[model samples]
Target: MERERESVSAMFGAVPEAAGMARDVLREALEKWEVRKGADDAALVLTELVTNAIRHGTTISVRVVRERDDALRLEVADGSRDLPRPRTASTEDEDGRGMLIVTALALDWGVRPFLGGKTVFALLKVG
Candidate 1:
């Protein structure tokens, strides 16, 4: 059976609920795309991106697009123009490992300017 492709976009406040909402959106998108492998990893990345936007940016938006080639692209846009960097962290550090995990798991990922802000995206291969 051919899998159906879909896309979803949302904008939310820089609040705690936004992360949960982003996760929910990702879950729905993944289900629609029938891509189960590494879904948890994707969810984690979504949370990290949303949380970073809420914490560091004045506004945030998320977009999930499923390509005809069976690739799922997840993008998180925020008001901040600064690009994200995955830095080495001390074992004792409470945070700073989110982007590292993304870089490790995503098939491909990067950042780009969007609507006077910046958007970080990850492309995940789906079946």
Candidate 2:
């Protein structure tokens, strides 16, 4: 939370509550940044990203940056070497639809390799 005015970020433990916490932080950031568009989609994307991080990796950190006047980038970094893959889920499946939801909401999303792990980022236009 001590980051720049155009950005807000938080680190989270690998817990179930991490998704909710990240979503709250993301909503606050969107409001503070005066971003009206894609607020709900951004929160949904953030939740999926955080949940995936908690489920698949450790040392999770969520960051939101005001990329431009019409764009915001949501980033979730985790201690995982394996990148995310969108999988097909059936009607009776209990899980494994995170990336599908993310893909449906985000304008763009990708992964970046880091020293210890990787950072997954989703771009949302918040005009």
Candidate 3:
């Protein structure tokens, strides 16, 4: 049987609750699609993306696209023109490892500049 494809987009304010709300939306989408085996990772990615947006940008938005070829793409956009760089972590630091994890796990990932901001995206293979 062929897999299904789905897409969703949301906008959020620069607040702490945004991340949790994004996670909830993603979880609900995954459940509705009957997607499994990467929901946790996806949720974590959502949190990282949303948190970064809230910290660095004036507004945040999330877009999730599930492809018929069993690929899922997660994108987070914010009103910041800066591009994301994956940094090497030190044991003493409590943060700065989210993108690294996403890079390690995602099939493909990149950043693109938009009208007033940039969108960071990660693609995963979901069956």
Candidate 4:
């Protein structure tokens, strides 16, 4: 069981449990930042980002901060320069569905090279 850290905004290894850890970090930030809207979707957005990074990269960095009065920026960086592609997944397919989740929750999202790799980010609305 992982406890929530008030300041878990740092790099984490590419491990399976890191996804859950990232959620804890987002939850902590939501409370600390006093975000009142779209808080639930923000958590889901962070989870999908971190999970995708852990699947394809080595070291992972997760950060959550208020990007503006109406949005929060959640970022997950990983040691992989390969960018994500858009693909369609059938209902029974277990793969290629992460992006769908991200799209559903994030107000805006994209990727870029950072920290010797790539960082995937999402902006979730707060109001």
For 8-127, candidate 2 gives per-residue lDDT tens digits of: 989999899999989889888877877788888888889888888898748799999988877889999999888997999999999889999989888899999899889999998777
Predictions: Cα RMSD each: 2.0, 3.6, 1.4, 5.8
Model 3 — which ten-residue stretch has the worst lDDT? 1-10
User: 2-118, model 3: which lDDT tens digit per residue?
Assistant: 765679888989899999989988988888888887888888877887887888848788998987647889999999998877898899999889888888778888999988899
lDDT of 1 by residue, 52-103 (tens): 7887747778998876546778899988887888999999998889888888
Quote each prediction's TM-score. 0.87, 0.91, 0.92, 0.86
Candidate 1: segments with Cα more than 4 A from true spot: 1-5
The candidate scoring highest on lDDT is: 2
* Pick by lDDT: 2 or 3, better one: 2
User: Which 10 consecutive residues of model 2 have the lowest summed lDDT?
Assistant: 1-10
